[model samples]
Target: MAVGEEQKRSPREQKMLLADSNGQNMTALFSPRFKSAAAMAGWDEEALLLASLVVEDTPDRDSKHKRRFVLHSKTPPTNSSRKRRSQRTPQPVAILDLDEEETPRKDSGRKKKGKKISEGSKVEEGGNELTEKNPGVSSSSSVLPCIDKLREELSCAICLEICYEPSTTPCGHSFCRKCLRSAADKCGKRCPKCRQLISNGRSCTVNTVLWNTIQLLFPQEIEARKAAGILNGRQQAQNLSPESAFYATLMNRSTPPSGEASGRISRRNVATTTSRTQEDEDAALARRLQREIDEQSPGTTTRSRVHNARMRARGGISTSQHEDAALALRLQREEFMQTYRGSQEHVSSRLPSSTLARANLRSMASRAMNLRISDRRR
Candidate 1:
């Protein structure tokens, strides 16, 4: 069958021929039966490929075209006829005068200003102090709800307290600098609030503008917190042991012993000293931890060296063991030599000096000499 004959076939017959074979003919050109059928029907690779796509698209395309055809056939004509208007009598137009005011009894601007002044005077002197609100002015103390809202905004999510040395994440969440550092180092570099990736930067800075605003708005709260922190710190310091106190003292002293002789340190000096002390203490702690780690995980060579040193100290495999071994070998060699000489003397005395006897004695001597040499070597 040629392509022209295939195209000439009725639509019903073509659908029947192209009906799906349970997806078995999906590789039409690969399968021998389908390939022969396609070749007989005058299809090339390009035509087969194009036909495959067409077959896959046919159902959707046919349904869409059918819908469009039905709509086009059934739809009413849009060329509507124009309607004609009937002639009617004209209505008279009335114009109102703009000379007179619409509201004749309205108060003048001067009267309004006078009334506002009178109201202000009444509030100042005649009105009850609490009830009347000053027209344009509001006291901060009265706006407690607004203050509370602002405090909430300033509070750190990690601590649930007002942010001290506040650090802002890329995700727009804010936390205290110390709290953020601890979380990033221990938990993860991802943000806790929004779980966005956070940069690992050395500097954990406070938002200065936010800090100043918070300080101004909540001065009392900030002062109270500072006082509480100081008290707690003093208590903890007092609780520390003598050893800890000694280290703390060493850390705190930034200058030489001679500098301590000068009396009356200022508050600024004390704060500076404490900050320096913290840095020193942190450095000392890191060094101590590193030392402990090195000691715990000593290298193979170091471990072997230590083991050998201990063995030497305990007299294990010493010079005395070596001396005892040498003495035992000397005694064994002497005993063997004495036994061999006795055997040789006995054999010589027992045998006569005749030709047969001499031969026998010679053989016995040779055997004894060989045995003695072997025993001495052992």
Candidate 2:
């Protein structure tokens, strides 16, 4: 095949060829992911297979390309209509442009050539009006109700996500295929979105137009999810119950650790049984006993006694070292106080009272001696 032809081959064709070569039958072609075994109606074999690939694998389509490729039915547009509009400016739709519904002519079991009026009728007419207030019955009521009923039936049970090839469980509830498969995986093939028994084995397919409508309404969301991953619930248990998960993560971030650590996990920790094994307790006991023996062993002992020595050393030297440290600390503090003493304090300690009293006595004695000498000379 030419490179271009090879590149354009649909995934369905590739899968089909692989299955046939491997000696598998038609039933193998259709799976939880692949919706149909038969080719798409109105499309050629190649087109049909391409579409299947698009649906099955490229769950997420390129957004830029979609503006040109996929047209959703929720939006009422046709290619011809778009082309027509493109040729001219688009015009607003007029309500008056709608045609009136035609009234049905009833046969009286015998053919009548002329119009006959009922006894209570106001005017001569071909048929009597069911209600005088209304001129004719309309197609709106019949057409609209069917559309509404379809919408209600197509909604998904889980995440209320739109049902794509929705599968119904024994409980009569429905979910998208990707959604249910995910639920099956996480909750052990049980419905995570709903507590339904998936193993009950009763299942059903989604209505096609309803499936198409979902594709239309949430094309981007579906495609993004498909391209990224199956949006179905393999949803972490936390996501299935968001309120609990959020508070738990928040609490975990804020929580302080126990003797476990300084900053503890506040969030609800979901440690697996295997992650915390029975052997852990035995290992812990072994470690504790080993440590006790090592601590009792002396520094004179070799490295075999290290664990016990280190642990026993915890309080063994703490007290003696602490007392010596405290004494050295007090002596250093007193030396600092003496070395840093200020001039004002030194002067105040040797202040006036005693010196002043002695100076006053010396002056009085000198005055008495001088006075005695002066009296003798006279």
Candidate 3:
């Protein structure tokens, strides 16, 4: 029936049918599907040769028109074509004779296929083994050791633990705020690591950057450290004696009746109180010494004597006071000599004979001279 339909066609109609068939054949030849089919069939050389012949036989205008039509119909759009081109393996340029290329091409294709299969299998086995061995391996697990190291770096030197409520000193060292505060209270305002002067922990600011990083990396550890600190504080509070606890409560009070918002006494106030007490004691001692001096020298007034005694005690005696001291010493020496002479006279009177009296007087005079010499030396 198809042959009868062809025979019944007019001459012009027959020419049109032939042209249409030719056009269709040309489109197929140039299409990507035809090229891929030829490559898969291992007929690259034959396909190229056939394409060359057809291209040579077709007129330039008809070939161009047909190629355009084939591209528009059978080929993908530009974007899709680019994507396919990227995905497609590049074909090597054929330079050798067909006979020479055939064996090598077949062998190479087989070798490539075998290598791809082996490599794919090896990769699948490796992935499966990893999954089986370490099912928990993930981004978080991988970062754990790094986080631990960072925790060590951010730990307090005093407490030897991760810092809780991290604070920074002037010397650029960081520590747990509670640890630093306790150290400052016990050992003065000094850094534990560097032994440099630091502000008290109460005055020190939190290291915001280091604190944030520590919080991000070790939230649970920070929470644990904080909890431990709270427990320790509670334990210490419980251990305190009632009197000590009461004193501590008084010291910590923010608002006391005494107009001082800081309930604790300042160093300046303590020093001033000490000095005032010392001055009062010194004045009392001066008054006692002046009373003794006044009793020895009846002419001096109490006020002048007290002032003089105080000045003398302070190593700033005047010329007049020095003369008065010398006169007092002279008077004491005279009185001693008179008493010694009177005692010697009484002892001589008690003797029975002139010879014994003379001997006793000589002995007593020697003794008195010796005592006088000793007193002068003193």
Best by TM-score: 1
True-vs-predicted CA distance for residue 240, candidate 3, Å: 11
lDDT of 2 by residue, 72-137 (tens): 445555556324423432111111122221222224311221221221122212122323435474
lDDT of 2: 0.41
Error of 2 at 21 (Å): 53
How far does residue 40 in candidate 2 sit from its true spot (Å)? 64
TM-score per model over all chains: 0.27, 0.18, 0.25
Residue-wise C-alpha lDDT for candidate 3, range 119-138, written one tens digit per residue: 54554455456567786642
Worst 10 residues of 1 by lDDT: 85-94
Number of the top-ranking candidate, with lDDT as the measure: 3
Candidate 1 RMSD computed on C-alpha atoms after optimal superposition onto the true structure = 39.0
Tell me the spans in candidate 2 whose CA falls farther than 4 Å from its real position. 1-157, 189-196, 200-210, 216-378
Report lDDT (Cα) of residue 264, candidate 2. Answer: 18
How many pairs collide in each candidate, listed in order? 0, 14, 0
Which one wins by lDDT: 2 or 3? 3
For candidate 1, lDDT tens digit of each residue in 186-265? 88887888888888634678887566555555554666777687557645764785434323432233222313212213
lDDT of 3 at 338: 52
